[model samples]
Target: MRYRHLAAASLLALPLVAFAQTAPAPAPAPAAPPAPADVPLIARTQATVPQPVLGPVDQALRVTPATNAKGGKIHMLPATLETTQWGWFDNAQPPVLTVKSGDSIALETMMHAHNQVVPGTTIEQIKKTRTDYPGRGPHSLTGPIFIDGAEPGDVLKVTLNKIVPRSYATNFNVPGMFGEFPKEFPDGQVKYFYLDLVKMETEFLPGVFIPVKPFPGTLGVARAEPGRYSSVPPGKYAGNLDINEFTEGASIYIPVFVKGALLWTGDSHAGQGNGEINLTAMESAFRELNVTVEVIKGQKLEWPRIETKTHWITIGYDRDLNIAYDLLQKETVKYLVETKKAPDEAAATKLMVTNWDCRISEVVNVVKGTYCMTAKTAGKPVAKLPTAETATAFVTVGTDADLNKAMDTASMAMINLLVEKKGLTRLDSYGLVSAAGDCRVGPPAGATKTVVCQTPKSLWRTKTASK
Candidate 1:
């Protein structure tokens, strides 16, 4: 959500201590020197758009890809202050690096709210940075990379090859910038964590270990619009999506907007729950993140979609959960219909209802998100929502915002309930709810919609001893 424009002096009055940072030290040397003015920045160029081979309209517009134009060149873009854009995405921003389609980039990304939150950084410093650049997102995105021959009506296929996270991470909950349960936690709290790469897991809370699954929290091409846009809320351009599914080996197809399809990424995370209920995940930096970019012509898409080895994920975003869910469903139907897998919309809807699992992406991103996952091959459907159990404890908590926010509150409340009633650790509860808890929307009451999530009764069957 776009926050109200605040005068520079107002930042001092706001609380920052509770929502600040401290972390690993960066070397004194300049992260990376900027390209010299005399040096040519464009690594590759295509004077004309490639001719297309017509094909069926599948999930990513089934058009054949242009010949690999990389020519064995890989670009390295470091996350220096000069190369990174703090909190905004503008089509007009100059490209730090440009390359032909089908090239790979070895990129480094900073922590949340941009790279400003390093060790010894103060709350006032973070606030000052915010005031310096008003009306933008807090993420430190690292490019408006220009891809030769990219233009509107084309699809940019981005493949994530490797994502190696830095040793440390941070998570926070700010009071003024409340997440799902606005009233539940009145104060802000920030926590730092050290990750173990060899173990491939983090001891989040004493004995509670969480598997590491790092991904770029935000990545997308420039929007069709001409001016600058806040990188806070995700749109068709795919900014600030915080989708956990974008881990290594996943590919996302984005619709080209302006020519060259200005691409950028930031807001990296090591691990996150499905809802991201607290507004922050394992917000961290990446030491080594590798990605390959390709431009596909003769095909277009209305929304961005992700492809994993096992399933296709269709994403939808809106302030209203119902509307977002509807958009996700329609996108799924469109993909099925275009691919000729379903004879018509009715059949596609049936198949979607039977085979797809709808999931809440995140509710804290100002704009809420919902997505559906359909297996690549036919099989029994997988369930995600919490369900009734034969012998256990179940609890439903209610709060108000959008329908998705209600679900967020329900999720947070259930997590607390699990920790208290089942003797489970907070991390344990969070992991359990994220992977298996189900949330539902109830009829709207007055100005606020009611959302509910419950723990399965079976949770009480086991004795959880917190280490």
Candidate 2:
């Protein structure tokens, strides 16, 4: 696997790798006279330290009560409760804090739940509670500070510093509720696993240890709509986007909704697979996340874009995979054409066909939703063609030809197809053959070849391709 170092521009004020192993000690006592209360907060802090705060929640919100439950009793706080079930608390909104590059943040949390043990409850009950009060259950939430002067059309960069889950827990479906293969097992079965909150440990398998990398499953800002919106589905405002890659050191760009884009983040997870098949992971209560946010003033995006140390990922969620693929293809084509200046459709198609580096990331959630990503950096560039003297005399292939002749014939056939079907000029065809052509034969020995041609820089100097 290829791993690129995080961009220096995105690593705002954050310490290197070893800094996050433990939290920093409290700042030393002030040596001189205490500063005046009237002094501006930003100016005062900026004078002392160049780095800005990355998290909106300050020291004040860190205080939370710790609780646990076993058997069937709400052990510690029975006086205030009507039933044995654990009760939910007020849903705190995520802080709208600005994050600059190189800064890392740490958070502390305690697990609190309303349900101690309710054997007869169904999926409906859990769903109802979650619906009535969001952000009270195991949730993921975190936002980064964007670079100053990032306009609307540009992208806001985020690099995750560290994601550590303090205490963790996983819940299984109750009897007659839900199952992985519901059609095969209708009755439903209940299983639960509890973690040692202090140790921060879990046993996913007999000999495996799953280290926690906490991240908010629903991290986004407010929508463009006037009133408050439910944090269920992701929209233009970027809410409840359950993308799993928002970990430490992974940068994300969200379209700005309002000035300063009040971003709210909550929902931390230990780990999860694509589509979150179970609608949950090893759901945990307490988490610490460090992030940096940069503002992009004018760069507007239709959907959220994420970049890890390795891959560039674009997410498309639609009701149909075909539609999603079409959108993905269009967006990728646009990126290639606009950025690389591939002049015409034929050149672009050749690049896609010859490379085949683009692929479907996942097919899950397609019936209800589809998520797909196309990568630009995964494929090797087409090789430049040989000189005219070495050009293999072109001949069309047919099914009747032998295997070796068929291969050569197929290449010629593709050349012809490019001229007839794609309406390429003779120069265009020749340039394509010389610079960007290759062939691959299938298992049954059928012949196939793809021709690739990149537009000269001068073409884009005059006009650009549009989606």
C-alpha positional error of residue 49 in candidate 1 after TM-score superposition, expressed in Å:
50
Residue 443 shift from truth in candidate 1, angstroms: 15
For this target, which candidate reaches the highest lDDT against the unseen true structure? Answer: 1
lDDT of 2 by residue, 1-467 (tens): 00011112212121112211121233486786665988645566567885664643353243224321211111111111121112111122233333332333343323223332234444444444433433222232333222335444545554565666544455333222221222322333222344544544444433223334455655565454443233334544444455555566777777765544555554445544333322344455444555555555555577676677765555544434335545554554555565563686667655544543332222222121223233546554543332122233222332332322333344445445556644664333322332223332221122332221121221111112211
lDDT of 1: 0.69
Alpha-carbon RMSD to native, per candidate: 12.1, 23.0
lDDT of 2 at 171: 37
Cand. 2 TM to true fold: 0.49
List clash counts for every candidate, in order.
4, 58
Off by over 4 Å in 2: 1-128, 131-154, 171-202, 205-215, 341-467
